[model samples]
Target: MPLAGPVALLAVPLGLVAFRGCSTCWVIGPTQTISSGRLERTCANGVCTLMKAGAAASPAATP
Candidate 1:
């Protein structure tokens, strides 16, 4: 039998969220860290920072 790729991927993320719900604090791209403890997705220069709750600058995102 073959494994379902989509299901497997989804399961991994879900499992992470479930197991490490609190410690897992990050995003995949640049972000504007809000005071409310949330990461806003954005791109800056050439790298994306999974910013904390309060990032210092709002650098421009590269295309």
Candidate 2:
């Protein structure tokens, strides 16, 4: 019983490192990206969607 106690303590960190390999196997969450050509854009989550100071792209579209 005394010998088993020391082994269990050492096994904890080893078990945690071993388990990390399989932890990222599942695609449980979404990976999203959004980009824009505008220069005044603000970025968040590795992407920029909103432009700054209302300075949008020139040449307004007409239909």
Candidate 3:
């Protein structure tokens, strides 16, 4: 019984710190997705970029 109490105390702090580290390591919000004929758009981590489809049937690139 006494062992459990001390073990839990140590585990709680370690778990909390570990969780805090992970919380900052993840990309949080500003995520979006858009789909068009031959192009797809993905926005994440405050940055947006384009993804093109290489299939021969895909639509041509647009300016």
Candidate 4:
């Protein structure tokens, strides 16, 4: 008897629900280049935030 089969059946629907909930909260727009680097626009709950490309490009090295 394999438990993975039953587990996956129950988990797939739950995963879809989680993804849909996340998508509703934030919406990301295309990236734009500036003098420094690039930037991404993110809108969440009707408020927008700018994300710098350089920072995201090398996240692991930053403190």
Candidate 5:
């Protein structure tokens, strides 16, 4: 087998492990933000709620 093939296959699992619990956030509009992933429980605005594992996003009421 070619060396490139093995390298490519190894990268897949490494990538998954590196980003397993990664979270990302996006600023939408002027005062709205959205986040996704397993590690996003709190944000800068302090209005986000803690979501249970496997649960969807559940934001707190905005003032």
Candidate 6:
């Protein structure tokens, strides 16, 4: 049909836009997991340090 050419032309641009948008979406999954894990570990370390420091200081302040 004569309409097939124009329809294909439109599909190409739409497909390209969709592909470009989704291309980076896959990368977020692994990176997000790794970064979140790193953040949690960093937060845990910070909390542990604070707790140790507070405990150490409490004994000195008591007497």
Who wins the TM-score comparison?
A: 2
| Between candidates 4 and 6, the lDDT winner | 4
lDDT of 1 at 33: 44
Name the runs in model 3 displaced over 4 angstroms: 21-63
Model 1 whole-model lDDT (C-alpha atoms): 0.60
lDDT of 1 by residue, 1-63 (tens): 257887797798778778775433555222324344575444656877666546677655799
Residues forming the 10-long window of minimal summed lDDT in candidate 5: 25-34
In the predicted model 1, the residue pairs found to clash are 43-61
Each prediction's whole-model lDDT (CA): 0.60, 0.58, 0.61, 0.60, 0.58, 0.58
lDDT of 5 by residue, 1-63 (tens): 589998999897787787675333212432232243444464456666565447765565899
Candidate 1 runs further than 4 Å off = 1-3, 21-63
lDDT of 6 by residue, 1-63 (tens): 999999999897788777776656667987877666333221343564323322333333455
List pairs with backbone clashes in candidate 2: none
Task: Compute each candidate's TM-score over C-alphas.
Answer: 0.25, 0.30, 0.28, 0.29, 0.26, 0.29
What's the true lDDT of residue 36 in model 2?
32
Residue runs of model 2 more than 4 Å from their true location after superposition: 21-63
As a TM-score, model 2 comes out at 0.30
C-alpha RMSD of each candidate structure in angstroms: 13.2, 12.4, 11.2, 13.9, 12.4, 12.8
Worst 10 residues of 1 by lDDT: 28-37
Q: How far does residue 25 in candidate 1 sit from its true spot (Å)?
A: 15
Q: Give the TM-score of candidate 5.
A: 0.26
Q: Candidate 4 lDDT, tens digit per residue, 1-63? A: 599999999997788788775543343322112233566676666978778754543333456
Residue 20 lDDT in candidate 4: 72
Tens-digit per-residue lDDT, 2-60, candidate 2: 99999999997887787775443433322221223333556656966655456755564
